[model samples]
Target: MRTRGFTRCGVIFGLSVVIVRLIGGSTGLVCYTAVESLDLGCLLRWDCLHASPNITYTVQTKTQGDPWQDVPWCVWISSRSCDVSHVFSDFELYNMIRLGVHLSPSSTVWIKPHKFDYSDFTFSPPSVSVSLKNDSISVKVQFPCATNRRCSHDACCPISKLIDPWTTVTVYNERNRSDNQSRTVWTQEVVSTVEFSGLSPGQNYCAVANFSFPTFSIAASPKSAPGCVETGSRWGMLPMYCVGLALSLLFLVLFLAGFLRKPRRDRTTADNPPKPLATVQDADSSAPPIFVDPCDIHVELVDDHSSIDSFHGFHKAPTSGAETKRSSQPTHFDHSRGVTVQHEVQDMTFESYN
Candidate 1:
């Protein structure tokens, strides 16, 4: 039992020595300040090792005759305590930081300024990125980090990563050099990115970011070096014009085809071979002749003794004298001896009516 007791005492002593050695050089109540000493322009910090990690700590401040304001610098509860390093004024009555454990919170502790012989502090600004959008411009502010803080293998204090304070931004038209007009906007420190509207299409713009606090103010690192962007339009009429042009070309092609082909179709119809006629009457000599009566016949008898009815109306073949029968006549006959031969004469053509 004595041996066990001795071993326990040795273990406890070793743990105490480790604790003292770890926090020996730390300032602001040891294991509180980021650096070893509380020199000029240094941060003052503290943390409760026994506090619950689930609870939150708020770093609030109340000036004379003013409501309490919550400064977001070192506001998270990773350290189980709050810090004040960014913004402060020498004229304020007191700055209170509160650690709330559920409904029952510890009393608000007033933080006094860490006084020093000299007071002027210098801070450099970070770079600002400018991006172009269809109708708006986006400006992103980035803060530079310390070499040792970012280079550390283990994350000793995560609170230092949140460094951006409240900022103000100014944007203006790049081409409006004569008028010298610009727009001003205030941005919260928590928001690293901000957008400005009322931008015209195809127009150039310039913007700059500025950081301001109650105690200090700083502009961008490259002063007066503004970022520029050119705006564009989302909707364009080129597609519509192209479609209309295509349609017009199609119509023109159709018109040309129809107009040029009409003549060929008409010529084909007009130049067609002629069809045969229905009747083909030709002159023929082998067919019988045709005739019709043109007049009526009339004749008058003279003092010749031959009977008028015996005179032939049309000519007939003359008979020989031997076959002629003798007729009574007022005798001027020239007859020969036994065969008396007589002469006869007749006319076939008629003259006009008298």
Candidate 2:
């Protein structure tokens, strides 16, 4: 009977354990997790199938053969993602990085480790830009690592090392909404720009690009945002060229005309000289003439002592032969009145006899 009672107790204890497990739910945390290298840093993402408000997540990382260290920025958080790049900053690119997760009020789960190589990182979609020429379209694909800090610090590092060297570019004619052409370009050789010629002018074209890596078994990245452009007509620039040419010809003609006319004007001016200053006449002829005062004057007196004696009262002096020839008259003088008046044409003189 005691043995039977012991078996009954054992059965009851097992039943009690099963009931407790059923009420408390799963003891393990089921999650889907992935790690990827992003332009900003290394990202750790998780999707918990049985997450609860009471359960928090913490991420810890360690290099090969090193003790696991908790990520300070990702400690006991409820977020589905965390950045563990800080932990890998001092590690080499070839090192193996181990990642772990701790769940609050639940059990701990650890994911597989990944190599810190560039190839292991996911390739972000290339940035694309399109421009239209006369009859061609130019597409420029910029890689994500072109602006990445890690890539910039390494001189020997090329974006092709991180992404696929083979790029697939698809061009679409927006009018028909169909793919017009496709080309696989080697990114290392062409750099970031590719030109597609033999396209119809005056048509709207769009392009999308993605990276393909068959060697690494990596699927092509998501297609880039479409870059669109409208090509110019073949004859669209002809009018501008013609106008510029015409303007140049006009300028040349005007310059030549001016240059040629300069010599002719010079010759004409030389032939028809200006009038001499002496021949110039004042505009107003009725204006008064200006008189000038003589700086010095001289007087000539004929030796007429006998005439002076005869002019005791008042007598006219006989004019000398030269004086008669010059004046055609004799000069008269009054002596008795103590006044002498002489009639002279060129130089007249008056004398007082008082």
Candidate 3:
């Protein structure tokens, strides 16, 4: 015949759920950079100076347009003997420039103009890229560059492993010199690796190789991707072993307690059993008396008469002869009317003859 045995399977299911949660919580992303833009060309320096509180010619010039313009020019004040030299054409383009002249003792001032051309400047990606490789895990990453600009013409832009894939590959326009000095400008952080993940075989991936920036960062992808780290059996087996051990210990304690104490209960049951009770009767009194010896015993004697004459109820002859002595001796006799006398002699022993 087949028989069903006791089995608890829920513990295994609960443990499996716990293991799943542990593995699921192990992978996630971190956002390191909140602001990702660098400003475009903005004026780094713009200044106006006034000379003297006096009603001196007080000639001042305001230069407008791009300050980085080169042209040779000079200015002279009619009221003062001082002349300003070395000015640029970009400043002269404006009509009726106001020049503020501060003359303490009438001094000549010299101005130096420096200009930069955009024709010679080029924007390049950062020089260094960081790639982390682990023997057991795989990663996916993308390198985003200026989308509207021709970023691929640069030489030796190191890319990630060929098998790696990229998404949201966007490129930004490089900022000009003016963008650097402005308070508000279209600026973006030059992000190197948009994503980082385990390496794959035969996949081509690209990351920005920074040239000058010393600090680099890594962050988790904002979007979810396939994250699976091949965890060994040991990771899951630890809790299972603990649960099994706890159950075994519990069962063992119960079994030992039952085993140790079961005999005492059995012995108690065996040591004491129900006994029969005797019933008392009202009229049944013919049973022979049963005697039990008393631990404390004493003997009492009853004497009927003390003198011989009283005992015999007769007078005795006072004679000194042998026959008289014999006749005078006391005798144990039976009384008339069927009366019998028992003589308890003073001696411990008594002799009788018939």
Which structure among the candidates has the greatest lDDT? 2
Off by over 4 Å in 1: 1-119, 146-164, 178-191, 214-224, 233-354
Instruction: Give candidate 3 misplaced runs (Cα > 4 Å).
Output: 1-243, 252-256, 259-267, 281-354
State residue 322's C-alpha deviation in candidate 3, in Å. 83
Clashes of 1: 0
Per-model lDDT: 0.44, 0.59, 0.28
lDDT of 2 by residue, 229-295 (tens): 9888768878989999999999999999999999999999999999865422453344465443333
Q: After superposition, how far is residue 202 of candidate 3 from its true place, in Å?
A: 24
Each candidate structure's TM-score, on Cα atoms with residue i matched to residue i, is 0.31, 0.45, 0.18
- Cα error of candidate 1 at position 117, Å: 12
Tens-digit lDDT string for candidate 3 (83-187): 121121221134122222223346422222212122111122323233334322223222232211122436422222111112222211122222111011111
- TM-score of model number 1: 0.31
Q: What lDDT, from 0 to 1, does candidate 2 have?
A: 0.59
**TM-score-based ranking:** 2, 1, 3
lDDT of 1 at 206: 78
